[model samples]
Target: MVDADQTFVIVGGGLAGAKAAETLRAEGFTGRVILICDERDHPYERPPLSKGYLLGKEERDSVFVHEPAWYTQAEIELHLGQVVVSIDRYAKSVRLGDGTLIEYDKLLLATGAEPRRLDVPGTDLAGVHHLRRLAHAERLRGVLTSLGRDNGHLVIAGAGWIGLEVAAAAREYGAEVTVVEPLPTPLHSVLGPELGQLFADLHREHGVRFHFGRKLTEILGQDGVVLAARTDDGEEHPAHAVLAAIGAAPRTALAEAAGLTIADRAHGAGIAVDASLRTSDPDIHAAGDVASTLHPLLGFPIRVEHWANALNGGPAAARAMLGQEVTYDRVPYFFSDQYDMGMEYSGWAPPGTYDEVVIRGDVGKRQFIAFWLAEGRVLAGMNVNVWDVTEPIQKLIRSRAQVGPEALSDPSVPLESLAG
Candidate 1:
């Protein structure tokens, strides 16, 4: 049991950090709970930043995890806009950016990720943006609004979830958008080429242009403001603004500096943690994007950068800190929305891990549940424009049922009834 006088310090102010603080208090940890946040605003949900918040459909108040008043009432000390510079494992304390030191009996590192920037020339120019934080999204929203109504052209670099979602939102704003991807099909690695082609067709139907198998060579700007982009094929595409939504890198500098066991660089360079989310140092635990822990189902160390992972990792880390026996083995899940189509995927598998793709419903109509199977066992499943079926899909994966494609593709056979 933790001593009542102990202090618990949490770094990073994203959902993971906020949820960890909530878990600490909920589990009756009366000790000092200090949350160090680098962001000016209190912890908030990020999904809306790229969607509703950007479109002005959702208010700012709705995005925050908790009101400032809630933290005061809970007696949790929230040091906003403060950066944690270093962790002194020997001293059992952390040094702030301003050189203030704070001791802690336990610490949770939930430092999230930042958007990856394009290394091309003219990225420093104004109107070139990446969407990982609220500020970035807000700036992109303003540009989208101004350029959208004029039917301005918006050039998107990368065709991942964020890029596609932003493309959809830009189109909704009446902007002519073009997505540049270096792959034959977008999301080809994750959803496989077949499903990726389905999405490609979907976007094309909405008049969104795509330039596949092309690389961004440079961003053309005039007077420090973006105007267009050039591809490797020596073709210039006009653009009022450019959004590079490639991916995000985990914020693991503190963990690396603290001498925590960092996984191989190929494995995402995250803080290597055990099944309980405990890092090399027992008192330090890493969650969120910064953690690369053993995945029970995958039998490997996979670090996922999804909302659900952060949401679930927080509570699990807190419980483990209290010396409570626990295993952080929940199946990974994520969702995306674009152009009247919604998708929810459960479970994780490396690209090419599965040999067969089984589908139910109608792909031609853009409504279907597709499962990726390896050796007749369901490894992952995705429901597109299909509702109230994620539970059954998750159950199917967990059961590890050796189900045939015929039964899996049969709409008459319920997923829950499989494995029997």
Candidate 2:
């Protein structure tokens, strides 16, 4: 291993790569640090693109984590718009698209993920879109800004966060929105059937059409603009725009090419990583959506693509690179804003391990929180507008305190009291 102050090369410039660079400085390592981002622009917050940014409430600049000057001032090289084509792990160097190479003592493979595209026919149509990058958001924004209310229909292929949020936004813009999800419930994999049903109700109440347990057979379009969607059931729904947010896959091509261990942790499928966020090769560290590591609360290796991981995993990976034996363990926290409602979930549900569930507040009243219970303790939690309570629950979960199911289901009990 090289000295602690040696060069660090990060492959992705999203949340993980950006925060890792920031944390390196905080840890007092002032050596040559380089961040290689494929995007042309500086690292910006992606959460807002579906919510505040789409609602016209936030400026693009306002969402940037750090201005370009921060990297320059900190003496960290920011190589924007550069794609790292391959990594020579044996040589401890990374080669870029331009055939230039940069060597590093320790590397961070924060290559993030790529948006899954529609494989069906007519997917090449012009009016179709996917929301993953800044350019994508711009294209969708242009469509919403210039479209007809009666004739304009946005057909979303998935009911995940981006799909649902775009549905809300499209409706706000007076565009008819139809969400096509193969799953029986919108967020079934994450929120359970009950809560997922609530989400379906919330959107249905607002004129959004839901086609559950259905798959898009093909997108019929002309001249690069979407026309309608032909479903597996032989049903056709007219559409002016098609948004494919089926999910994302781990960008593991470069990692695999470099002889790094790659697994099934792509898109709906998860990857496998150790407790320290190290791939099969310890020299190459992974983070963000692309990584599959041991979940702190569940005590199991489960790969998740969450906002909290992108934010927290970087610091953990950095600590490991700095030789500070740290684990990427934390309650998996993620939130979504839908139709003026705040929905959040924390902790991890051990695979097929949610033996019981307890609830607080009123689910119908829209002020509820559900606690996932395994062996009568909180493993994960979901809340609807009960954020203040979510904080204490998060702490209790991190501390691994023994808060019983009785108190968890009672509304009179304060969340903090369960911490001890």
Candidate 3:
């Protein structure tokens, strides 16, 4: 069924699109592959943007998904720093910002997401930064270094993963960091109160100040430079720089303009797609953060924005496009490295979904595995400072087995055997 005459145009050159292009070639698809990116940089992983790269632990060139020569070697039409303005679905063509149009037999949207901007006053100031791109990270790295050198203050909004990671990085540079969060604790929505408090304590131990249960009301600045951040609680915190790590919204403008069905806010507000990653238009597929797929196991439309999803979802979409039987049922997985702690979380267990959180090992020592369960069934597992357990944890979730708390909390019990 493969033909050399056919062409596949993939919009967005993040990990998902790049991997999709790689999958097409690997799956023996002789069709022409074109990858488009709005950013000038090559496809790069984002974790390093906050973790290693921002901390100066990783090289600037280490973030790219593949070497620059690899795309050329694979014969992928790499269109860098070019924006696709419109998608004429009916004509099977996309119009770029430069007034160039390209026809395609199939189209893939991996547009990903953008950082939610701070809406308060003075957000447009010079010291206000958002971490979502390589360029943003590059600028933030310099900001952290300057803040550290001058013993300046950095005020961060939101206590989510990005905020916390950057807080750790700023502290590593000996910069004073203050986190203003609307929630009661860090990562409250995802990890619940118990684990959230643990993270709050962890950051506090590293000399990070947390103004919990407060939201940034406005940013105070002078001459287009940030001075301080005012919270809803009538407290103004002196800040040399401010990082808005509130969250990200899926980049769905292109898909929406193309008359594609977008998921509601409850389903991640992304481009709605089936398990096969097919959009409303059968010929148009989506993946990565932009695609909200109806999950087979979860029985709900879910969009995962983590690196693992992009790493796997793209290849799955490519296989589906190749007319292969595909089910993108991968359990949502994510990892975080903050300060001295390294953690991997597998499966979904949002606050309301899980009834009890059982912990194994020592919490004070910060070496533990926490399992979230609903009616004895393990919904999610987070291993902190633990290694080689993600496979077993995922198996436990996929098996949908009723695991006992006693066994789950026992270090002697093997997780793999429990799944069996």
Candidate 4:
């Protein structure tokens, strides 16, 4: 149990930060708990910013982590619109933007990530936007409503999850949408070629156009407002607005400046932490996207940027901060919704490492359970247009059981019965 007089300070204001605060109080941490957030609003979840919230199907208040009164009731002090400028390890204190110093016995870094800005010429134009925060989504919502479905055309650069989901939302708003990707297919690096093609087909069926294998050279604008995008091949795509959804880079500057170990160049830049989520400094812990943790299962350090990691990692880090023994071994998981198709994937293996993809259901009909296997052992699995099977899929990966491809592809075989 934590000492009653000790204080804990949590930096960052995303889901991971909020969850860490909740865990501290629930796990009997009676010490002083302070949550520092740079945003004007309280901690909030970001998934809805691109999906339901952007489409206006969900209310604005629903996205916040908790009602304003929850913090007061829990006795958690909140520092809103305050940036942490420096960390004094020797003094065990943090300096805020306004020149205030907060002392802490233990510190948690949950600084999430920021959207990658396109460096092209016209990206700074008035009509071009990147959706990373609630305010960005709100602006995009206004742009969509004003443009309407038939009145505006949206050119989305990049075909990642954010780009595709935003494309779907734009289509629902009755706007003509076109997506451009440098790769041959969308999500090629993560889902591989065949599964990537399935998503490509799904978008095409919904009247969305694709410009695959092309590089965006410039964004054309008129009077400081975006009007079109020009590719490297001299092709011009006209647009009333542009969404630069290339990707996000983990927010690691604060951790880096604090003298924490960062992952190597190959693994990407993330605050390096152990299985217990403790950084190089024993008193400091990192979680969520900012942490590149040594996975007990994968045998390597990986930084997962999905919602599940923050939802689960926050609690694990909190427990570790209190000197409790814990290991974060959950498989990386993420899902996507585009048009009528919903897909869930669990486990992680780099794209080219898996030898074969075994399909248990029909792929032609767009409903199937696909497994990524290497040397007859299940490494990862995905269920597309299928439901109620994630638990079984995760079991297959965690158990590390070897099964023949014939058995994996056979519909007569039950996923639960196959492992034993």
**lDDT values for all models:** 0.88, 0.82, 0.94, 0.90
Cα displacement (Å) at residue 370, model 3: 0.4
Model 4 segments more than 4 A misplaced: 1-4
lDDT for model 4, please.
0.90
- Least lDDT summed over 10 consecutive residues: which range in candidate 1? 1-10
Which numbered prediction scores highest in TM-score against the true structure? 3
Cα lDDT tens digits, model 2, 86-159, are: 88878899999999999898899887778998999997788878888777887787787665346488889999
lDDT of 3 by residue, 12-68 (tens): 999999999999999988888999999999999999999999999899999999999
- Candidate 3 residue pairs that clash: none
**TM-score, predicted candidate 4 vs. hidden true structure:** 0.97
Summarize candidate 4's per-residue lDDT along 122-228 as a digit string, tens digits. 88889998998899999999988866744788999999899999998888888888899999899887788868898889888888899999978899988998788
**Model 3, global lDDT:** 0.94
Off by over 4 Å in 1: 1-4
Per-prediction TM-score to the true structure, in the order listed: 0.98, 0.94, 0.98, 0.97
State the displacement of the C-alpha of residue 293, model 3, in Å, after optimal TM-score superposition. Answer: 1.1
Off by more than 4 A, model 3: 1-4
Clashes of 1: 0
Residue clash pairs of candidate 1: none
Ranking by lDDT: 3, 4, 1, 2
